[model samples]
Target: MAEPRPRVWVSQPLIDAVIEPLRAQVELITTDEVTAWTAEQLAARLADVDGAIITLNERVGAAQVAGATRLQVIANVGVGYNNLDVEALSAAGIVASNTPDVLTETTADLGFALLMAAARRITESERWLREGQWGQWSFQTMLGADIHGSTLGILGMGRIGQGIARRGAHGFGMRVLYHNRSRLPEAAEGEVGAQYADFDTLLAQSDHLVLVLPYTASSHHIIDAAALAKMKPTATLVNIARGGIVDELALADALATGRLAAAGLDVYEGEPAVRPELLALHNIVLTPHIGSASLATRKAMVQLAADNLLAALNVDGAAARMPSAINAEAAFAARTASGDKSKKR
Candidate 1:
């Protein structure tokens, strides 16, 4: 008799090119609709699968995984896994992994694009011209801040942050400043041509500030009205990080009252739903969290996630090759403890 193939659930349809490998080897369950899932909905689906490939939209926590007795692994399709309760997964002896390197450059490119677009009022001008409001050309009509020779401040100095720093320093003639929990070493600073700044200094000194920090308890609403008050009134703000990192209501007030200049945002708190106040502002540019949305990059992310799922499931051809597991130690420790108890029994 043949052994039963492991079942894998896909939260949503993935890139067509990356689905073939998964289809050939696993008993697959998948969804075509981009429907939002409540924790209950996700738990219901995960209860019977050995593993699952999911996106950030699915918030998988302790309660959500309570019914998932057979689940062993979760493969997140994006670099940020803030939506996942990793501690809960670790306690369940479930290994959770993410796709990181594949999206770094793509996300960084989008970050810089948003920075420049907001700084120079590109989208606003386009709207102005389209509205037949370009009848008169004045010297200062659409005058905007210059990217060249500006001071660029990055709030988080990870791989994507380093890429943005390189673009600002090497591609353009901008002075790059960065603030992380700890400063990068001198060697790394030189490679990116970036200087270290304290948080308050980063806020005050930068001509344009970008947020790229991961979402965490300490980082939620890190940028609030109080923080925004420290920024230059003429400076621009860009957030390609998670939405919870910035207080959206405070941001709206700042932009509406001219407390800050212009702004750009890719992610939002409770996303796919924008605050009506932000939508009313013409000085802000909003994107639907597509920092890693390039066709090639999206494909790479799905493939990497599939590889992680395969390895974590102990699937053939992917043996002993766990890639990008965030809580590998915890998962392994729990597994070992389970084995020890089983041997005694």
Candidate 2:
């Protein structure tokens, strides 16, 4: 009798060209629509599959994985895996991977675009024009902040943050200041033309400040009322990071009261359901989470995730070839110990 092929599940509707090829090698279970899977559904679906490819919308945790006896790997299409309980996955000996580098430049482009929009009042001016308010052009009409030769501050100096720094310093002739948990080396800083600053300094001195940090417990509500008060009142604040990083109510208050000049956001604390407070304000530019939404970049992300899923399932080689497994080492160690115990029994 021949061995049954590994069964894999694709949790969301993905680019067909990138995901369809997996069908030839494995018994593929796929969804054609974007489904909001419940915890019970995820637990039941995962119980029978050996591996899964998921997007950020699906949250997998201890309860979801409790009955997943045959599950071995999960490949996440986005860089941020806050939706996945990594600790639980590691404890269960299930390796997890995320697509990171492929989306860096694309996301950085969106961040800079948002900064320019907020600084120049692009979207707000457009709305004004659409409302027939541009019939007479006044000298003070839509006066906004300058992007060139201004101080650009970045809260997290990761790959995306450095990309923004390069654009600001080299392309726009702006001074770039970055605040990170750790400072970069001299050569790396020179390449991006970025200077390291303390967090408060980054807020007070920046004409335009962008947040690119990951979301952790320590980072939640990092930009609250107190933090916003530290910023220059005329500054532009942009957040392309996780929504929880900024206090939404505080941000709305600042924008509404002119405590801050203008703001732009791509992510929200409760996304796809933005607050009426933010929508009612004219000084803010809002966009759905599309940081890595370019066609080329999104395809690259799905392809990388497919590669990770295939490698982790040992489709062609050993289960250790996943390119970006977050917990590969620990998961493999746990699996090894479990196998040894089974053999002893």
Whole-model lDDT values for every prediction: 0.90, 0.92
Q: Write the per-residue lDDT of candidate 1 for residues 1-345, one digit (tens) a residue.
A: 876778999998779779766878989888888878887888899888889999988889999888877888899999999878999888877889999999999999999999999999999999999999898778889878999999999999999999999999999989999999988999999999999999999999999999999899999999999999999999999999999999999999999998999999999997989999899999999999999999999999999999898887777645676778889788768768777311110
Backbone clash tally (model 1): 0
- Tens-digit lDDT track for model 2 on 89-172? 988889899999999999999999999999999999999999998878899999999999999999999999999999999999
Per-residue lDDT, model 2, residue 103, is: 96
Query: Residue 294 CA error for candidate 2 (Å)?
Result: 0.4
CA lDDT for candidate 1: 0.90
Which 10-residue span in candidate 2 carries the lowest summed lDDT?
336-345
